[model samples]
Target: MPERSLILRPLPPFRLDLTVWALRRRPENRIDRWDGRTYCRTLVIAGHPVWIAVTEERAPGAPRLRVTMRAPVLPAQAEERVRQTLERLLGLRVDLRPFYRQLGGDPRLGPLIVRFKGLKPPRFPDLFETLVNAIACQQITLTQGIHLLNRLAQAFGRRVKDHPEAPPAFPKPEDLAGRDPEALRALGFSRQKAQAILNLAEEVVSGAVDLEAWEDLEDAEAIARLRALRGIGRWSAEYALLRGMGRLHIFPGDDVGARNHLQRWLGRRRPLDYAGVQRALAPWRPYAGLVYFHLLLKKLEEQGFLQKTTC
Candidate 1:
């Protein structure tokens, strides 16, 4: 296996650590790994499992990332695919300047923005991964969800060619479509969730559902179509929109943790429901989802999972 390297120039003020934290969410997440300096993940690209390691170059106003990839045999488009996937995963192209200008001077949010300057809203590698994540996390704590996903990946995901001990890539639809629902149940998924995951995988593998096609649809339309799926609901649909399709306008109102985050951040005496969340986020409009990520980082920092970086 030959190793290859490339450089990615992200929009300035980019911090790979913060964006990776937002992507990994819980410290327990095994799929996306960050060991203080570098971020690493294995992806099954063009039928080969490639291990990617990315590190920040730390330029003052122009940040660059160094990406090193190792695989048994690199496909012709491997670098391009890996580059595109990393761009989406770390939100390298998302210019938050408009978002900054929108509410930079606000008393409460200003500090949060300043505190996490280079943080970007990250997305799952693809729509299927996003939906699978949403399904696994339904009604469960994020840590538990990540644990289940880790188990699922270990059970079905493809391992790197030379590193059998490394954590496997997240399972693809083809990897799980023909799998037994009972096997997922053995991994601590409920029977309903197990069936839903299998069904979704089958649909994706069979070409019965074109999850990528949702890219062209508006947020509401996409949500409605996603809700039509077996296990997807309002929250899952909106989550996919924000995290999968890169629609930053969506803040999953049904996300309990986010609602609690908002309630606490807003200093609200009463707990906020879906409607209350919508109302509270109305002013932020398109950037509300960005707010959600900021609050999530705030929660992570408070929990000691994220360290304060000097600005």
Candidate 2:
């Protein structure tokens, strides 16, 4: 199918760059590509491969996304997936008004919310990708972890020939499940990490683990379920809760990078341990994850690593 552009009317205060950055994490991310003005990715929609490039413009007092989708599927079918993907990745329906009204007055987090105004917390395409990402990032620098993910994508992910830069979708469970751990180890994963990935994949494939069922679970319950899995610890579980399921209040308390940001934001002299982080974030209730996203943007801005938008 030829490329087609459709419009998506999002709730007020939506910034594509902020949402894309939150989803993609780093400028080097290959799965979600942002070229400043637009965000591009190749998604598997209804089992059909599609390429979508998304941009936004203001319309009649509301923000709207201009989505261009190209694939072998019909435009109408592709539009539905495009809309769904944007809603998931950009958090279009997530109402931050209450959070803003509550935390917007805080001395520490208030300025952060202002700095990254219109920011929305982003989630992985699926629970499987979220778990895979957490496994890859365990005890490693994020850059290295993402490199491993890129290699893994090139190895097993599928793509269309429509666009040269269409990032291959993250590999499916069928692609990784039952594969030899050494195959993943060859992509620079630790042996244990490789085995863990394979195990999780197999479990998902075998119906032993239903990650999507966590949607009906509370944050604590979801965290406990994720932690019960081998190779997933407190940080990994909490991280998955936030990034995988969009549990916006569940900040990965053990995240070193987030801890650093929290410490600096609070002007603390020493680093915050997991308990300290919990204490500091207690008043925020379920919005500490929002603070994490803002701090991530602050770091990227300070380092001049945030992607540039042409529009």
Candidate 3:
């Protein structure tokens, strides 16, 4: 089959490179691949594996993207599915103007926000993946966590047979629902984590849970419901709210790395606990998650994985 192409116009001040780096976080993330120019990812669409490549045709403030997809059989509505998924994943339609205006004259976070103007808060395609990520990353370094996820994807995720070089898509619930925990354990998941992933997958597959339904609930209600699940806790629940539901006001205060980033960026002498994180970020209410994303980009830039550019 031939590759199908489409044109997309994201809101201005959108830089695909910056947005991708924010979504990918590290160069080692196999699931989201960025090689200087184009951003490529394998996605499962309409029961077929598709390889997608997106390139920016114009700079920020007049942004345009050329999206190309190659699949064994192009499904009906494939273009629309790809468009909506990319729009949500890349935050193509989100306007950051109000956020920028809110940061005016702020001595602490003004420069940081200005430095990474086009970065958007990216999300997992669904709650199942978000929960899996939170479980995989609990109490571990991000690098190790991403390695475990890559292994999971390589093992159970759908692959495009035609493009062996492209990484496999993140596993869907059906892909993992019937697997034994031992299988996940072999891929570097702890016993508890393995079981948690399997349990969530099974719940999704059996229709016992509709993870997407939480999108309609308020933040507190959603968090409460999420915490009722076996493996989810405060941090995981909050992380899901921000990353899965795109609730920009909910910052995962219990995230040690993010807390450290906030403390250091604020020049606090003492290390911040959850309470301290909230108190310090109270002034930036409703946009603290945006701050979290900006801080993450700053860290990635410092580590040489990404570079700052004008929007």
Question: What TM-score goes with each of the models?
Answer: 0.97, 0.94, 0.97
lDDT of 3 at 196: 90
Error of 2 at 141 (Å): 0.6
Give the range where candidate 3 is weakest over 10 consecutive residues by summed lDDT: 302-311
TM-score of 2: 0.94
lDDT over C-alpha atoms for residue 120 of model 1: 87
lDDT of 2 at 260: 92
Report lDDT (CA) for all predictions.
Answer: 0.90, 0.84, 0.88
Off by over 4 Å in 3: 59-61, 307-311
Residue-level lDDT of model 2, residues 77-122, one tens digit each, is 7777778877887898888899889999888788878888888888
Candidate 1, superposed: residue stretches over 4 Å from native: 308-311
Instruction: Give me candidate 1's TM-score against the actual structure.
Output: 0.97
lDDT of 3 by residue, 67-180 (tens): 999988888888999999999889888888888888845787889877887787888888898999999999999889999999999999999877788789999999999899
